[model samples]
Target: MFKYDLKKTLSEKVFIFWSMIFPLALMSCFYWAFGGIYDIENSIDTRSVGVIYESDNEFATYFGDVLEQIASEEDAILSVSEVTDKAELYGLLEQSKIDGVYLVKEDSIEVLMNPKYSATDSMILKAFGNFYVREYDMIEDAVTSGNIGAVATILDGMNEDADYMSKEEGIFAQAPNPYLWYFYSTLVMGILFQAMSGIYIVEQLQADLGVRKVAMRTSVSPVPKSRLIVSVYLSRLLVALGISAVTIILMNRLFKVPVGNRLPQLILLVVAANMFAISMGEMFGLFFKGSMSSRSGKGTGVIMASVFLSGEMIATLPGVFERYAPIVNDINPATVLNFALYRLVYYEDLTTFYIEIAKIVLVTVVFLVIATMKLRRQKYASL
Candidate 1:
């Protein structure tokens, strides 16, 4: 029965199409739309700056050294180039070869920028100049007074400040692209296709339409109803999970969705999610079997509503609802999946990951139990 059921599940063309092929196609579309966004956002860092120094001036040389030091640092904010001639420097600035030009004065540095370019890069240059000018008097005073200790202390403090600012930990952690929310939300919605397959699992067992002809035949067999139901569940579970694995692999490998280092944990989350969706599908089928005239229609509607609320369709909906009404995320399967994946990629905290897994398991168990009760109470009219 297990072997036959498995074969039957795998052989269904519509099942394979929706479960596997459709997601692969959808993933391609998602990549096309969102792939370039990361590059655009990352362009904000490491702007090019042209530096023309007054070599004889001590503060200018000092300011140039500061630029070199900053430019050499890891994940540098500026790329510095020295221009010996003012015409060449301004020419580079005009051509947009550099973001801004730094003119060194005795006490301070001046920023030269073209109005056509974005002001952010020039603003950064100006800020750096302002900060250095603000501190130059102290350095001059310390050197003239022969306060060698104070000079060392100030240089050391500046180096320490630079190091601290360079480290991108805590608040400066790299953010996932906003468009990724749509990809993740869509992935979760695609995974919910399991629930659609799940609805059929319940429908096939219940005495129903032409699709249930096999159920009618299986009922007359000597096999226990419990065993038959278990076989169906196991067969569909394997199919659903197999399709999910394919979807995830395509997303990570082909689409480059950045599933991260927690590959095994991600597979586990997929497993738990499949279980929840399948169980929910079964519960829907059993609960509404005779009650609804069009069980599939209503089931599909519910799944669509779940997907919409999960923010699969609208990217901001998830953040908006999550921020305004926290309770919605608690019940929405799509939201739970979104949060779990987000935690895995961004935080990589196992405690929260496992908690989400547990929640999915809990949801699965609840629906499974309810469906089991309904199936047990079900008595068929002889065909």
Candidate 2:
């Protein structure tokens, strides 16, 4: 089977390239360029803070706009909110809506409310505050000291840079970076397992070798047909895990991503998910005959359904997404793995984790049962 699958197989080499080489190459690049740059964090003495403006001072408005832009970027996350009045802002603070606030005045800005927010972020926020002061002072110096009168001389003679306030504050905390694994579990895990599982199913259904082995070997060998199918299915499950394990290691070792505590559990989730997917593939395969033509349609359907229903793609889809979201997300094992990993790593909240684990197991059982039914009862021409 290995030699035959390797020889005429159009996709085998493609999968090998994607599973091994692509991840190693991509991750090595990230490790060198990004690893050190991200390590620099502000100290506890200074705070990086987000500023919000209600009526909007000139300095306040400018900083607020910059904050919004920076927040959208990867390096910084500025949580800023604008309201009509102080009353509204205060209400938000009381409700723990905003992490911290910067109230901009005519001369200076103030950080009001939450102190638990990262000290570095708060310092950066307050650095914006000092920036306003320095700019105002520079303009004041030019006007009052008559530097503006001799502006050309000052510009020509001054060789030193601006003496801006130093950035010396950072929130000192330990938060695991879950972005890498979450990205892996959500996107890569889903597509790879699905395609492999579905393709394996297709292979089994169409191959005369599989039929001959099963029909001839199982019936007389004292092994139950159910056990025979389970054994075959288990082999495929191990193969999927083998691929996933290598991919995960390459990603982690090269990129040095913090995948979180109980990494073994996450691997368990990966194994169980691939098994479920293989079982699903087996069930789907029963629909196709020896020609293997039907596998494409089924494969396409599975891919579409998995990606579409995955909450990661569209994100929001009204009530069906939020209310029945877990169910919808369950339609894609990748989503299950992602949400589970998110909980395990970042959220550290266990309620949702247990539920997702249960759902994964349930889905696996259903698919396995369906595959067994198809294998035992379905009528088909010999391959």
Candidate 3:
């Protein structure tokens, strides 16, 4: 029965296009449109800046020393150039020699930028100035209050070698890529498309729905209804996973998307996702009174809406929901699956991943229980 169901599923042309070909094609379009932009936007290089000293106060000297130390680091973000006067600084800025200039006053510093300076360079310079001023104010307050211990603590905290945060390595050492969101969401949409198969499973088993002939034959067959349903469900799930595996391989190899090396966890998430999607289809089929095509169309609409809300089309939608309506993300199945896949691959957050898996499992069980009860109680009248 499983083999027969598998063969039947593989032979569906609509399933082949919707689940396999369409996703790959969409991925190709996304790659061509946004791939180069992400690469250029994410790249960060050292920036050049000029520093002019108009005052020789203690704070000015200390600030200069801080800049010198930061510029000397192996992976320094700034290359510092010392200017003798404002004339030389303005000269460099006009000539495009330095991206920005820092003017060191008596107790504070000012940032002057070239008209053509990149936004990234301007932001870095401004941020450094703001941070320095804030830290200096804290130290000044400590000294004025005669808090000797606080002064010492502030100085110790300012040490360049002080470690406040540690980086935890995930399965991949690659930096985060925002563009992967589209690809992952596309993969999710493809998986959800498998819900059509679940609808078909209902069409075959329930005597009152779908094609009258096939439904009646399956309903009266000698095979136990529970056993038959399990066989069909497993077969459809295998097909979904098979397609997902191929999608992952293509995403990693062909498109250069980093799906990470955590194969075991990834497989587990996709399995749960497929089960949830299929069970959702089962619920739709059992509850909605309609022909198979009508039910399939409604399922597709719901899935598309869920995907859109999960940021499949607009990348910022999920973020908006996260900040304003977080519960939308928690309950939306597509969002849950997308978050699970993202956490699994980029964050390597197994705790969140397992939580998402539990949600999927819980929903799947509820859907299956309702669907099973409905199928079991189905009665047909003899003519």
Local distance difference test, each candidate: 0.70, 0.52, 0.77
Query: Could you tell me how far off, in angstroms, the CA of residue 231 lies in candidate 2 after the best superposition?
Result: 2.6
Identify the candidate with maximal TM-score: 3
- Per-residue error (Å), model 1, residue 53: 26
Q: For residues 40-127, write the lDDT of model 3, one tens digit per residue.
A: 3242356788888889987788788888888899877778876657798789889998878888898778889886654335545765
The TM-score, computed over Cα atoms with residue i paired to residue i, of candidate 2 is 0.52
- How do these models rank on lDDT, best leading? 3, 1, 2
Worst 10 residues of 1 by lDDT: 163-172
> Tens digits of per-residue lDDT for model 1 on 257-312?
66656678888888888888888877677666554336666776787787788766
Model 1: CA > 4 A from native = 38-176, 208-211, 289-293, 381-383
Which ranking of candidates, highest TM-score first?
3, 1, 2
Global CA lDDT computed for model 2:
0.52
Report the CA-based lDDT of candidate 1 relative to the real structure: 0.70
- What tens-digit string does per-residue lDDT give for candidate 2 at 119-152? 3344444545565555555655786777765655
Worst 10 residues of 3 by lDDT: 163-172
RMSD of each: 10.7, 16.5, 9.3
**Taking the candidates one at a time, how many backbone clashes does each contain?**
0, 17, 0
